[model samples]
Target: MSTPMWKRVIARILEALLAIVFLAPLVWVIICSFSPQAGSAQSDGWGINNYLTLFNYQAGLPTYLFNSIVVSLIAVVFSVVVCTLAGYSFSRFEYPGRNLGFMVTLSILMVPYASLLIPMMVWFKDIGLNDTLLGVGLVITLFQLPMSTFIMRNAFNAVPKDMEEAAMVDGCNSFQALVKILMPVVKPSMVTVGLLAFLEAWNNFMIPLYLSSSAKSTLPLAMVNMRQQTMGVIDYGATEAGVVILLIPCAILFLVLQKYYVKGFMAGAVKG
Candidate 1:
């Protein structure tokens, strides 16, 4: 290993090259988002005019952003809560049809996602949940459940049963032990589930397309609508601006939670 200076240097060079290749498109988008374009509202000069145009489009950036945030938060909370309980049950308890039930939940993943949305749209409409942000969030949560449950169940299984038994011996009820002890131990998995749920709900287009209205559109849907111009011309400047806006939060979230997210997956993989 000490004699491998040349190999290390070559590896560094390759990594730099790969980074550049990956970053080039993102850099281009950021630059293009600020550059003035023909027929753009801010064609006067290079600036944030494209961003201003995006801000003013449709019901405005704030409305779409709020819609996206609300839906994503709902999905994150619902996914974490439901998956945590389901995973714990599947891993710790023996109930009739338990294996069959878990199998059914996982089987949902085998179905086509797009096909599921159409029939769900009809059901949601019948329940008066159609055309609402809550409906879209529920759909996102449903899709996240299978994978989230699997991750959580494995995470719970990775922990020693003796810890739970010890807590019970100390007079803590099962629910109390889970809440005060096991939940903290599994925090990383919960974070992983929440983050995945948030990202899916934030960027999901199909669910919103079928379940939400124009007024309740999320940022991705808003971006698609904003890209169209009169006479079929695409507004590249504002579109790039929208792309940058959409990318920023996701990038920041992943960077911030990278440590926990990796740990969560590793914890789950340990037992299964």
Candidate 2:
């Protein structure tokens, strides 16, 4: 089956094209960020001044970064806890409405975030949960829960039932079997779900816009205001620096859990 030179070449070409298409925006952002401000003779020149300003707190970046990190982390933790329990229940327990319940979870996944905005705000306001980090975190957790649950459910299903039976025979209770054995085996899936949830919360703008107070504006909202303020200026160095800051946590998270994510993806693909 090694007679596919033309096909291999074509595949490589297509991959390269896709990579360029995906990377063009990031490359442009980096270039624009390093470019000199208008009226400067040195156009397209690179400098670290943008990063310097970011660290210097001229743009309230520190507060934004802190707010984003706090909310994203909290959201991830809450989502993981809720989803792991629910997924385990759905996977192992034969209960009434199990299939119907999964269908409902799938239905939630189909609904776009935009459709829930107004109703979520109204509920948040009624409960006095508005304009707070906890409120934003809870909203992010709620939005991400169904997807994470679905992922974890499939992960749990992929585990061998024989192992659970053995654990039960060895005097292990249901909780002990899950925590001591199954949880360790499915660590990769948990990591994948957690990282994805964190990214979603970190990049969230609409929720933070409506739910976060001015003093607790997340990085995305801060970036929006920065863009508006610098509209006439040719220099986008600071803006790019902000984006770099916004991307750091996500980049680090993905790099650390890339192996797990790949494994989870493959496992889910197989199940599907």
Candidate 3:
């Protein structure tokens, strides 16, 4: 079922074309971030000033970066721990209404986050979780749990039942078997879940804005305020630089965890 030579050539051409189309904007942004306003780079003087200005700003890019990292890490930790436990239970244990319970959790994934905002805000206020980083992190964690749990469940479920049975034969209890054997098999899922949770939390805007007060703002909200306060002349240069800054950690994270991400997906998808 190999493609004809002409078809293979066409496919390759289409792929190259699509790659350029997709990468064009990213290349343009990188160019602009280094481009100067009036010289040669302006007169051959386009340097990393925009990136420098991003650091030069009052709040300092580092502070915003730290905030994003802290909030995302908190949310990611909650997501991994809670979702792993819930996913393991769903995948490995039997109990009354287990299917119904899973269905309920998965149901939340279908609903958009926008739909939950108002009710969540009210709940946050009632709990005194409002106007705080913890509140925003918790909100992001809540939204992330259902989908990540589902992913982890599928991942753990894909572990062959024989492995668990073998462990039991060797005197391993259920908890011991999970920790000693199954958890390693599902490590890829853990990386994937962690990356996804971190990205979602890092990029979240509405929850942070709604939950934070003037004294505290996550990077996304801060970016918005920075734009507004600058009036019409939004520093596309600086903004682009900031966006590059925002993207740095996400890039590093994916690069570091991409192998696990791929492994987890393949394991889940190919489960027999």
Pick out the ten consecutive residues of candidate 1 with the lowest summed lDDT: 36-45
Put down candidate 1 lDDT per residue, 94-201, tens digits, no spaces: 989999999999998998899988898999889999998888888899999999999999999998999999999999998888898899999999999999999999
Q: If scored against the real structure, what TM-score would every candidate get?
A: 0.95, 0.88, 0.88
lDDT of each: 0.91, 0.80, 0.80
Question: For candidate 2, lDDT tens digit of each residue in 151-257?
Answer: 88988988888998899999998889999888888788788788888999899999898777668888888766655343365335666777877777787888888
Pairs of residues at least 3 apart in sequence or in different chains that clash in candidate 1? none
Clashing pairs in 3: 39-42, 39-43, 40-43, 40-44, 40-45, 41-44, 41-45, 41-46
Instruction: Give lDDT for model 2.
Output: 0.80
Clashing pairs in 2: none
Better of 1 and 3 by TM-score: 1
> lDDT of candidate 3?
0.80
Which has the greatest lDDT?
A: 1
Positional deviation of residue 143's Cα in model 2 after best superposition, in angstroms: 1.2
